[model samples]
Structure formats: C-alpha cells, structure tokens
Target: MVKLLFLLVAISFVLLFSLTDFSGESPKHGESMMSVHLPDFRLIPTTGASGPESFVFDISGDGPYTGLSDGRIVKWLANDSRWIDFAVTTSTREGCEGPHEHQRTEHVCGRPLGLAFDKSTGDLYIADAYMGLLKVGPEGGLATRELDEPLRFTNSLDIDPRTGVVYFTDSSSVYQRRNYIGAMMSGDKTGRLMKYDPNTKQVTTLLSNLAFANGVVLSQNGDYILVVETATCRILRYWLNDTSSTTTPESRGNYEFFAERLPGFPDNIKRSPRGGYWVGLNTKHSKLTKFAMSNAWLGRAALGLPVDWMKVHSYWVKYKGNGMAVRLSEGSGVISEVFEGKNGNKWMSISEVEEKDATLWVGSVNTPFAGMYKI
Candidate 1:
C-alpha cells in the first residue's frame, strides 16, 4: 500500500509539472547600467486619426509624413503646426472617416503602416498592410499600388537613397493586421523580408521563415540591409550583393546576425542623423509571456482561452504603462544608449522613432498623439 501511494504521488507531480507554465526568469532590461539622460516628451496630437506607425521625410525636409489608422498619410506642417492629409492608400474613403473604423474595416479601407521616400524622384513609398506596396508622386492624393503580389501584413520599410531600391517586411504570411496578436501568441514563423526595385518595377523575396519580421533599413553605405524579427528578438543583416540567394537557417552563412536578445520586442528602426540607429521597443519583455511562449502545449491551450483572460495573464497587461527605446552603434550593433519613460506616464507601445535635428519624434500604434523629445 505504501509503495502504491508513493507511485501515485510521483505521477501527480509529473502531471502538474508538465501542465503548469511557471514563469521564466526575466532578462536584464537594458544592455548596461550606464544611464543616459532622456528629455521630457511633448505630444503632437493628430487631428482626426491615430496610430502613426511609421514616418519619413521628403527631400525638401518640409515634413515628417506619417500613416494614420484612418487610412490616410498625413504630413506635419511645421509652418501651420497642424497635420494635413497628404495621401490615401485606398479610394474607398466614405466609411473610413472615424478613427475606430480601422478596427473593423482596415482590410477594405487599407491601413498604411510604413512610409518611405524615393529621394531622387520625390516619390513617397508606402507599405499598406492590406494593399501591399504603393507609391505616390510629389503631388500626393490617392497613392497608386505598385506591387501586384498579395501580402498578408506589410509593416515597415526603408529606401536606399542612392539606388532608389526599397526594402520592407511582411510581418506574417498567415495572419493579417487584425489578427496580429493571434500570430504572435501562436509563434507564427511565416514572416518575410522583401525588396522592390524602382528601375525594373520588380519585387523580390530576400528572406523567408522569419518570426514576425517588423522593420527594414539600409546601411549608410548600401552594402547591407538590417531587418528586425520581433518575435525572436533579433536583428538580421542581409547582404545586398548576394541578391540571388535566399536566406534561411540552413543558408545562415549568407547573412549576419546584427543583434539578438534585445531588451524588448523591437518595432521600427530608423537611421539617426547623429549616426547609428534608433530602435523602438514597443513594450518590455515579460517573464510570464516568455514562459507561455516557450511551451508549445501552453501556447496552443492559450488559443482556447478567452483573449481578455490571456491578456491579463500576459506581461503586456502587467506592465501596461512602461516604454523603452534604444540607440545602437552602426557597425558593431552595440547598444550605445537607452531611453526610458519615468513614472506611470510611460510612453507605451512605441511604433517608430524618427530622429531629426537632435530631437526624437516618437509615434505609437495604440496612442492618439505622437511625441517629440529633445536629446
């Protein structure tokens, strides 16, 4: 009887250990403890729209053009201190008036996530989550679709200033913008990094099988392009010279690992005028989220549970108000400095950080207003 009872207790322990998802130890927040001073941020409210996911400036440097939730790309008029609608990705503008329309009708109205410019021709390139890659001339209105192939979730992009070639990310081939959270929770690995050439009007897939590829930026010398994989918390550098090859785990020799195990899930990366790159940490990494993601059974079980319940148990809910951003050295990919929000008024869900004239222009996907901080 004693032996039987001991066997039963051991089986129970094994079952509990297998079924329960205990939180993993949290990683260090930033790369180093050397503190960097961050100035207080001031908000620049968008007139009627929200969620300026990315930004780019024209050759004249007249504006920081940003894409909003209401399916319009607006430019900040520093002269008038107001946002003016510069372009629209979709022609269907009737039902896309309100800000909340993106939640329900983003596919029909088009949600433009990334914005870039062909400095040589004054053509603005946009990555619309629903409409694929597009471009509008200097006289902006209804932007014309450039890429014919379908994309699941086009997120962010950057253009090579010299060649006018564009590089961008398709966040997930399985999930659209509305189901982005589902893709993240399920650990989808179908993201892609692609390039578009203006001269030939061709689209080429550079890399595939990525874990939520989010951002792309060309090196100053145009030798390599840096791409961010958000779910894996790493940055990948693809060689522009090796255009004929496709990158994968097996073909790892073709590309280089730029950065790994970042402090947070990185979103958009922009070239800083002062040199190096500014990376936006949408949110800090949570130990609980990591534990849940580490286990395949726990991740699958999460799909059956209520989304609100799962969110409450996740790290994002627990650390709702905090935000972080980092600056990395260009060639070494070293974390040179870290910027963080103090107190409960955290920057929260930073989508992009555009650096200009020693000021950081911060945008958020969840917030209604964009912010500017003087460095």
Candidate 2:
C-alpha cells in the first residue's frame, strides 16, 4: 500500500511540473494554461456497447455520428431523443454483439476508429481497424471497403470539403487495438499518414514511419493538415500545396511541429466553430511517457516487466472526476478550455471532443456512452 501511494504521489508531481517550456517560442498550452470551469457532461448512452472513438457531423450538421465496439456506426437523433444505427463496418460481424467486444472479437467484428463525411457527396468514410478504409452512402447501410491492401490499425480521419479528398492515419502495422499498450511503449514506428483521392480511386502515402499516428485533421482552409503522434505527444503539420514563397515541392514540409510538449497525449483533432482547433487529450503526458518516447530501451524494459503496463499507466495518471480538453489557435496558443467530471461520470480520458452550436460533444474508447456538455 505504501509503495502504491508513493508511486501515485511521484507521478502527480511529474504531471504538475513537466509543462515548463524553456524554448522561446509560441505559448504552449499545458495544464497550467487552463482557466475555465470544468464541464458537467450529460451522458448519451449507446444502449449496450462502448468505445465510440470518433465523432463526426454531416454537412447539414445533423449528427455527431460515432462507431462502436460492436462493429456498428450510430448517430444521435435529437428529435427522437435516441441513437439510431447509421452503418455497419465491412468486417463480417457474425458473433459481434455485446459490451466490450474489444477484449476478444475486435478483429473479427471490424472495429471502426475514425469517421468523416464528404460534404459534396454526402458519403461517410470510415477507418476500420480490422477492415481498412470503408464508406457508406447518405442512406446508411453496410459499408463498402475502399482499400485493396489491408491496414493493421487505421485510427482517425478528416475530410477536405473543397477537394473531397480524405486524410487518414494507419496507426501501426505491428500492433492492433487489442494490444495498444504494446504499441505505445514498444517504440514502434510503423505508422503512416495517408490520403485517398476519390477521383482516381487511389490511396497515397504522404508521410511514412510515423510514431503511433492517431488523429488527422485538415486545416480550416485546407492549406495543410495536422496529424497527431500520440507516443511523442506532438502534432505534425504537412503541407499539401506550396503556398509559401520560401517553400518548394522538394522540401516536403518536413519536421514541422504544429504543437509540441502537450499536457496530455492527444487522440482525435477537429476544427472549432469559433476559431483554432479542438484536441482530445486521451491521457496525461507524464514524465515516464516523455522519457520512454525518447529512450527506446527504457520503454521496452518497462513493457517487459511482469507488471500490467496498461493498469500501471492508467493508475499513473489521474481521473479523479476531473475531465478536461483544450482549444488551440493556428499558432498553438490556448484559446479556450473545458475540464470537468461531475456526478460520477468520468470523461477524463477522451478520444475526441468537438464544439458545434455551443455544446462540447465527447467520445471515449473506454466508455459505454458519448458525452455532451453545453456551454
């Protein structure tokens, strides 16, 4: 008991003090930058399933549609006051039914991670972990597989409205969602940031050898896109076109940090209605994570131990009924913030959070329901 308490207290200090940035750059948003009140999330239950990892709205702004652990994509119907089935994944989900299917049948049932909708075509594109890229029409049904080659762990995505091209991430070839803890700590670098061109029906890889690529979001005007590297706690920017006078095609917009040294490890990123972007911080960015990311041997040693790395990592961070998220400007400055977990509803570990019509819609990979907090 004494050892457990010591571990908790030591990690708390690490979480508190790690945000001090020494480099004279733009102001980074850490735990210290938060100044808003914690939001009390109103639960939106998924009936009997969990892990709605991504939230996306249609062009008409009718949905915050999400995919579930049970190989189903569902949308919230506000007028009917319930969630309705929108689409099913490409994997054959013959035995995929019940809560927390991720523990056993995620691969068999086709676990969908990221979702986006094309404004021009009204088509919903999905990045299913087991079945690669898939899409459904405006009238939802069984999703059609988009890619010929399989992706091991397709994570998140966003659509460019003007061009109708899709940007997505392949998390890792070595690790699937069933053992994400291994991917996070094993120093695996098999991830990629890719795009699918609808006109050509071709998928192209823009960036390769990414470390745990998790979320992908195009900039507000589609100048460039940002992809979150979860293991490194930083977001990378890759330009699609040479807008700047100094940049050339050969440069490839290499090694640009959109945001770095984040307070928490990011999951999904989305555009804010007001300005800037909203990032879903899945867990605290502790010193162990920072050191482990830099030193491969330390990461492997920690994972090699007999201890359950998932539980140790979980206990190393705090929920404590204090959920939080951040809004960042294009310059990486904190514009607005929200943090709360009231009434036994713990949303501290978020998969994605987006603001539309003054409400914060939240998704988590570990929860049975999505959450809503009105401003």
Best by lDDT: 1
- Candidates' C-alpha lDDT: 0.78, 0.76
Q: Which whole-number lDDT from 0 to 100 does residue 258 have in model 1?
A: 86
TM-score of decoy 2: 0.83
**Model 2 worst lDDT run, 10 consecutive residues:** 20-29
TM-score of 1: 0.85
- lDDT tens digits, residues 1-375, model 1? 755655554454335434543221233565543222434667889878778888888889888989888888999998899999999998998888774536677788889998888888999999999999999999899999887888999998888888888899999999888778777767899999998887898899999999999988888888888899998778988887777335656347568788887877788998988778888877766554455456655554455544443333334433453456778889878887776665455665777788998877888887788888777
**Candidate 1, which ten residues in sequence have the lowest lDDT sum?**
18-27
RMSDs, each prediction?
A: 6.3, 5.7
The lDDT of model 2 is 0.76
Best candidate (score: TM-score) = 1
Candidate 2: regions farther than 4 A off: 1-40, 243-255, 305-323, 333-346
**Pairs in clash, predicted candidate 2:** 38-339
Which digits, one per residue and each the tens of the lDDT, describe model 2 over residues 122-145? 999999988888999999999998
- Candidate 1 lDDT score at position 93: 85
